[model samples]
Target: MGYIILSIPVFFLLIGAELLWSAWTHRKVYTFPDLIANIGCGIGSQVVGAFTKAAIFGVYLWTYDHLRVFTLPANVLIWVITFLLVDLGYYWFHRLSHEVNFLWAAHIVHHQSEEYNLSVALRQSWWQGLFSFWFYLPIAVLGVHPVVILTVGALNTLYQFWIHTRAIGRMGWLEHVFNTPSHHRVHHGSDPKYLDRNHAGSLIIWDKLFGTFQPEEEEPVYGITTPLRSWDPVWANFHYWADLVALARRCTALGDKVRVFLKPPGWRPADLGGRERPKEHDRTNYLKYSTDAGANARRYVLVQFFLLLAVTSLFLFKQDSLPIWGAWVLAGIIVLWVMGLGLVLEGRRGALTLEAVRVLLFTGAGIAVWMSVLGWSWWCAVIIFLGAASMIHLTALSGEGEVAGQ
Candidate 1:
C-alpha cells in the first residue's frame, strides 16, 4: 500500500495526459461527475481495504504456514513462476466475478462507469478484495511465499492500470499475448456480444486458453447491462447486493431465495421470468446516465474532491502510525465526505444541507485528530478556512444554479 501511495502521482499524471489527449484529439472521453464517482469509489475502496486486508490476507499467510506442500526456495525462477501464478489466480478471480452472482456484487462497481478512461481504472468495489483474496490461497498452499504473492500481485494490478485508457489504440502483436486496452475495453462493454468476454489480468493467454477471449469488433457500449445511474460511490458498492436481497425476498421457494446470490446476475426463478438476458444494444438510440449539476455546483464538488484526495492520500500513507480509533473515525469521515459531495453533484434534494453537515463534522474531527497529534497549531485555521469556504459555497448554491465562473 505504501508503494501504491507513492504511485499515486504517476496515476494522476497519466490521467491528466489522457485529458490532454481528449482535448487534442477532440474526443469526449470523460465527464465531470463520472470522473469524481470513479475516483471516489477508489478512495472508499482503499480506506475500507486498509482495515479489511489484515484479516483477508491473513488467510493466505496462514495457508502458507500450515498447508504448504513444499518449502520452495526464494530464487529468480520461483519469483517468475509465482508472478505467473498470481496472474493466473487473478484471472480466475476476475472471471468468477463476472460469472457468479455474489462476486459480481463485489466487482460491479468497476463496470458502473459508462465512459472508459484512465480514471475508470481507479473505480473499484470496496468488497472486491475480501472476495478476491480467497482465490489466491491455492498458490499459497502450493508453497509460494506470501511476500512473493503480495509483491507480484501488486505489479500485476499496476500493469492493468495503463490498459484502462481510450487514448491508446490496439497494440499490434502484443494484443495476442497481453491484456491490452482493446481487450479490457471489451471487458467493460455491456453489449450482448461483448458481455463477460475478455477476463484477463496481465496475460491474455488465460482468456485464450479458457475460451473466453473475444476480439474487439465494434466499439463497445461501456458499463453493465443494468446501468448504475447514481454518482454516490458508497451506494455503487452496495446497490447490486440490495437488488439481490430484494430479488431473494420475491422468491417463493427457500432454495430459490438462497440461489438469488449463488446464481449468475440475471438469473431468476421460473415464476419470475426465468433469467434476464442482455438486450441487443442499439448504439444509435442508447443513452448514458446523465444527471447534470449546475456549473457552480460542479465547481464546488471539484474543489472539495481534490481536498478529499489529498487528505485520503495522507491517511493512507500514515494509517499505520495513527491510532486505530483515529484511523477508523477518519475513514468513516472520508466515506461520508464522498457521499455528501456525490449527492451534491447529483443535485439531490437536501444535498446542500448534507454537505454543510459533512463540512462541520469532518472539520471538527480533523481538528481533534490534529490537536492530538501536533498540539494546537495554525493548521487548525487552515482546516477552519476550508470548512468556512465550503459552507459559504453551499449557501451561494442554495438558490443559484449555474452562476458565473469561480
Candidate 2:
C-alpha cells in the first residue's frame, strides 16, 4: 500500500504525458467522463482495500504459519523465485476471473471503460483484493513471507500500469517476452477473438505457455461487449452480480440457480436463455458511452473530483493513525463524492440536487475539521469558499433540464 501511495505522483505524471502525446499526435484516446470514471474506480478500490487488507493479510499469515511445507529464507534468489511465482499466481487468478462467473463480478469493473490509457490502468475493481488473496495463499504455504509476496505483488501491479496505453507501439522481441501495451490492449479488446485472451500480469510467458496469447493484428475495439452505459463507479462494480442474481432468480431448478454464479460469464440455464456468447462488433462503427454535460457542470465535476482526490490521499496517508469508524466515515464521504460527480456527469434528473447536498456535506465537514483541529485555519476558509461557490453554481444549473451543458 505504501508503495502504491508513493507511486501516485508518477502515475499522474505519466497520465499527463499520455494526454499530451495523444493531443500532439491528433489521436485522442480519452474522453472526459470516461477518465473521471476510471479515476473514481481507482480511488474507490484503494479505499475499499484499506478497510479489507487487515482481514485478507490475516488469512495469508494464518496459512503461512499452519500450512507451510517448507520455509524459504528472504534471500536475493528467493526474491526472484517469489516474484515469478507471484506473477504465475496472478496469471491463473486473472484467467479465472474472466472464465468464472462470480469472479467476473469483481473484474468487470476494470474492463468497463471504453477507452484504454494510463487512467484505464488505474481503473480497478474494489472487491478483487478480497477474493484474489486466496489465489496467492500457496506462496505463503511455501514458506515465503507474506510481506515478501505482497511487495512483489505490488511491483507486478506497477509493471502492468504502463502497459495500459496506446501511445507505445509493440516492442519487437519484448512483446514476445513481457506483457507490453500491444498485448494488454488485445486483452482489453471487446472483439470476440480478443475476449479472454492475453491474461498475463507482468509476464507474457504465462499467456504464451498457456495458449491465451493473441497478436494485435487489426486495431482492438476496447471495452466489455455489453457496455455498462453509466458512469456510476459503485454500480459498475456490483451490476454484474445483480444481473447474475436476477438470472438465478428466474431459474426453476436449484442446480441451475447455483450454476448462475459457478458457470462462466454469458452462461445461462436453457430455460433462461442458454449460453449466448457476445458477437464481435465492427471496429469502424464502435461508439463510446457518453452523456452530454454543460461546460459549467464539467468544470464543477472536475473541481469536486480533485478536491475529493486530495481528501482521499490524506485518508490513505493517515489511515494507520485514524480510528476505524473515522476511517469508514471518511470512506463514505469519498464514495458519495464520486457518486455525485458521476451523477452530474451523466446529467441525471436530480444531479444538481445531489451536488448541492454534497456541497453542504463538505462544508459541514470542513467546519468540523477546523473546529476540532484548530480554532481557525486557512484550509477551513478555502473549503467553505469552494463549497459555497459550488452550491451557487449548482443552484443556477438546477433550472436547466436533465441534460446540462448541452
Model 2, clash count? 2
In the range 120-191, model 2's lDDT, one tens digit per residue, is 999999999988888889999999999999999999999999999999887998987899999999999999
Clashes of each: 0, 2
Q: List the residue pairs that clash in candidate 2.
A: 294-404, 294-405
Q: Residue by residue across 225-319, what tens digits does model 1's lDDT show? A: 98988999999999999999999999999999999998988999999999988898888899999876788898899899989998898789888
lDDT of 1 at 216: 92
Q: Give the TM-score of candidate 2.
A: 0.96
In model 1, the runs with Cα more than 4 Å from the true position are 401-406
Best by lDDT: 1
What's the distance in Å from true for residue 84, model 2?
Answer: 0.7
